[model samples]
Target chain A: MIHRFLFHDINEGLIRHAKRYVLVVIVVVITCSMIDSMSAYFMDYFGEYWSPIEYGINEFYGRYPFVFDINSTDKFTIPFGWVLIYLFLAYMIGDYIYKDMNGYGMYMMIKSKKRWYWWISKCLWCVAVNVFYFGLLWISNIAYSWMKHGDIAFYQESDLRMSYYGFGFDNMGMPKLLLVVIVMPLLVGIVQSILQITLTLIFNSVATMTIIAGILMLSCYYGSIYIPHSYAMLIRYFSNESDPDFVAVDAGTGIAVLGIGIVAMVVMGYMIFRKKNVISNR
Target chain B: MKIELKNISKVIKKNNVLEDINYTFTGGCVYGLIGKNGCGKTMLMRLIAGLIYPTSGSVCINDKILGKDISFPDSIGILIENPEFLNDYTGFENLKLLAGLQKNVDEQEIKDTLTSVGLDYNDKRKFYKYSLGMRQRLGIAAAIMGKPEIILMDEPINAIDEDGVAIIRDLIRGLVDKNRIIIIACHDKEEMDYLADKKILMSSGKIVKEMIV
Candidate 1:
């Protein structure tokens, strides 16, 4: 019975999400355009053929570790492509549970006969959305490469990436590319989305969403290894891999941190939501 | 089956919504929770449905305490406040989706419930295009679909027309049985007198009067 309810709930979420398919596709097209144009500009300037992995690296490659200097003045610049992708995904998925609780979600909760089932179904729903969102990102990039007649391979111009993004890439492999593009971003997306849902249970939707967006922005401004958002940026890994002052959080550490973060947030949310007084404040 | 609320009280933002409510609801009866807008009728309903926990009380159903032995009533249905559904789904589809949770009722049961509430079972209009009365009918249909042991409806007839109200009144009356409990929260005193076996009048978060109908 629980499985049946979960299946239906997930289907409901995906169906509702389908209404936004056109909008999501448009966002993807615009994002892909931006990334492709930037790659073309860099290729024209450097006079070299860039692989698809270079575009992927550039998309996930955020700013290097920030060092605060009192004497030298430098403006904090955000990685537009990276921030746009994460922030947009956050906004897309951050409000469904909150809104649903006031609406049909409460009805479904009573019907499911267990609060844990409802919460778990929502967690799984978030995971599904993140998967779909990231899958679209990958497919969009592939389609863009195909359209532009670009080489699609697990290869990166190490020198170009190093001089341009200030990162040291000793070697590039398929595992590394997949880790950065698919695994890391997807993990962060699921973790942040779950965190937002948990927070919305305690706060209003606007406040909760703002808190999530603020965390992402702060991660961009300061590349502290302690910040989980830093692990999503590939530049952080390459830049601090050899730096003695910073402990390089590799893909394994990121997966561990984000995986644990997902479990902890799920448990905490279940504990709070099970005892919560569900009222229609919205 | 019996539902006993032992000294129920709820405080929201430091304001007492339901103050020390102690009541026992038994099977084979229709209960009318009568009050104005914010006199705790809906809060009392919420407490009973296990949608909200009482600050210093426990809702016990058949000796099983809510929040301890069970999270909610084992078999219960509710339509609190306004009816909310996915706007893109048809009325039948909405009920079908909800009915999938328990899997206790089939498509025929859902279609019958819709017809019982004066809604066309084959209506193809999306819920967003439904009128106020049609929405109310769908809400009532959802609450009563599976013949739950306990049913809670708040303002179940707010936007219903005269003919629709008559049809629903008869529907509720026909649902009375030896093993079922039906509770309705409404503002119409006449309708309460007509339908409820007992009328509970609440004022300022306390039960001010109880009249046998």
Candidate 2:
């Protein structure tokens, strides 16, 4: 039963979509991190210029790729790669679940015997993908740091802006930085993925995709860290652009809320899945 | 295993697929359901397999309600709509993947089941390459391989040749003495007459006639 329900489902999940997930993460994360690192080292237009090492760490981990200096006249724009990652992850998961539910409903569900088990297996697969994707992103950040500041042990940020130094990088070591940025983003990604997959089952796939995309966009536009998807964004939650002063929630609270949100989404999704008549409507 | 359906009805988008179906199927007999296209034969078989829940009533096996006591049948093999499997995998590989889920049957058993269905167990041809008849044969093999307590088949020989049809007829006919419940849906009346110990005729989501042969 375990083999059929849990292991096999996870194995198939990893084999089928994991490649696409990993390939996208690696290419985008690496390219974006490298570009941000290069700009930090080669170009210094601001009064608050730090070494490329400091810039690399700050650019990779900063919520907004937009320069944070008060004197900068450039319109603020962060790396769009982060946005694409969240959107694409939700899309892949939602598409897969909805297709399975509609296309071959009889073949898979009947063989599995337990509806909840089949759904849970899917959830497990989503979690695995999210973790691996974020883990690779963390590595890309590390690489950027290494290339910009060879053998650098300490972090330096926004020498012209005193507050920037203390906000995220003041006296912080690599270990602490990793915990705040890498681990938190992964937890948040898993949470959002869960919500997306379950909602796709409940509503139309396009509607669910659009809803998730709208929420993330609203969070970014409003500079509010309250969106569930925002929790997964290390920079947005910590140092938002629209509401930089609004730091009402910390990492601990953010993680807790997101975790609770996952439980709630799963509960609601499971209820709908159990009661819904999963026939071949397609 | 004895299967019973009490006042079962299914309405999808207001299309009454099956309405007020009441049935009691005992083991050790082969039951054939005959109906025109769009009738509820396929829906009824799905209800027995616990693939889709009824809009109104419940299905019970040995007095245990499906939705309450179990989400799906504890032990059953089904080929509902199409003879489908992973297109990339060979016939043996497909069977092996599913059989590995329960470990209920070994490699030798899967090979034997494929052979029993007149499929070459060693055939390396992928599922995508198989003709409609071969795919039907594979579906039949999957539905009956482990010999679960209950078997649900829909149009099991829709695309097979004459000899293949004869072989499947004999294979299905041989299952009556095993004390298992077999539910089959087909359009061929002669085949239904020859194989099914009981026959049911359905039209417009209702059972029109039932005869014990």
Candidate 3:
């Protein structure tokens, strides 16, 4: 029954506007490939010159007291590359799924009857699309690595060493650096889908979505800067590091956070949609 | 099988769009709801569809308040203003999706509804390419696809050509004769005259006249 519903929902949007959706996907794929290639070129040339040893040491002593140093060589490039890929795909997926105007302040589609069913189906679709996008990044990363260094195992030793030192990717037993590159941005995308759906339900406009995204970005910026030491430590402890065991523990924590964030957003979105009026804005 | 609204009022941003409206629509009759633009025809239909809430009063269908029942009256179908649709789907596909929303409706029924609305079901052309008249017919087709006992349509005749209007007139008339209650919210006097057994008029958020045509 759920599959039937999902089939209808997905085909309903895709069948009517297949050309438009296809066009969007094409644009996204091309843009992502270009950006990935450029970044790979730059990293190959400049990555070795940027080092986080000094920054990490200073922060460890509390003199340059940031929770995490953003410049660690293994710490930065791998995650940064993953994030760029995730974000590029997220933006494309969001464009395909969200019916808001093209960066304008209007939501052309309104939730009418079958509100819960539609919401759930769309949420599942977003997740599926994002996962597929993440898969693409994984594939592309392998391909790019092979192209750049003539070896698919370009970063294998670095990934293993970073995991051993307790400073690397931490999700699902993957290399800590790789996990950060992929998981963190994917989590952010999932959260964004939840947030956009909820705000659209509550306020019923694309304008509201923009405003909400702005508020959230600002809050996250400030929160990251001023978070207490205890909370920072908790985040750092859960972060991918050079130790394999710690990486495993932190990976579990990251998965838990992702699950909780998705559930919370979905529950909140469903409640708001169920109760809110389906008033026509036009 | 019956719908009743008691003292229903809707206030949005300090403007009362619907005010102190008390109305009852029993089984097996066609009602024409006539009003000027902004006079709450669409608002009242949405309220009845359980798509919107009134600030005061209650909407009861078959002795149960909307939102309290396990399902909205399995017999009620609605086409609110502007004939909103999943624009990405073909006309047939759109109707098929709506058909799944109800109970016991089959593919044949959906195909029949499309035919009755003068839509070619086998064609794979998307609804976005359809003419306004075709889109309106598709919307009506969706509303009546389940053979609902009570059908609510807002401006069912707008944007359609004369031939399209005639098709809707015949469809509504046939449904009414089958003992279904059809409420059509429209400004087209010819359509109301052809289909409505009774007519209700509104102005500035209140019912000003009720006449049996």
Q: Rank the candidates by lDDT, best first.
A: 1, 2, 3
Using TM-score as the yardstick, the better of models 2 and 3 is: 2
- Across all models, the iRMS values in order are 1.6, 2.4, 6.8
DockQ of 1: 0.76
List-wise, what DockQ does each model earn?
0.76, 0.48, 0.33
DockQ of model 2 vs. true complex: 0.48
lDDT of 2 by residue, A1-282 (tens): 543545555554555565576655465555545555555533354433343334334433435423356876766554465567677667556576665564333455666677886677667777877776666555555554566546334444444334343354544456755556566667777888888887777678888889888866665544444566555545553544454465634676777887888788778878878876665543
| Candidate that would win on DockQ | 1
Question: Candidate 2 deviates by what RMSD?
Answer: 4.6
Expressed as tens digits, the lDDT of each residue in A83-179 for candidate 3 is 2333343344443333421100011112123455656776776665556554544455454445545655433333432432334323424454334
List per-prediction Cα lDDT, in the order shown.
0.81, 0.71, 0.58
Docking class for candidate 1: medium
Mark the 10 consecutive residues where model 1 chain A has the least summed lDDT.
Answer: A239-248
lDDT against true structure, model 2: 0.71
Candidates ranked, most accurate by TM-score first = 1, 2, 3
Give the per-residue lDDT digits (tens) of candidate 1, residues A1-282.
556555755666666666664544565567556765655666566665445556566667777665566876876688877887877777767577877777888888888778888889888888888888878777766666666656565565565565555544656466786687668888988988898889988988789878987998888877665577878887677645534566556787887888899999999999989888877433
Best by lDDT: 1
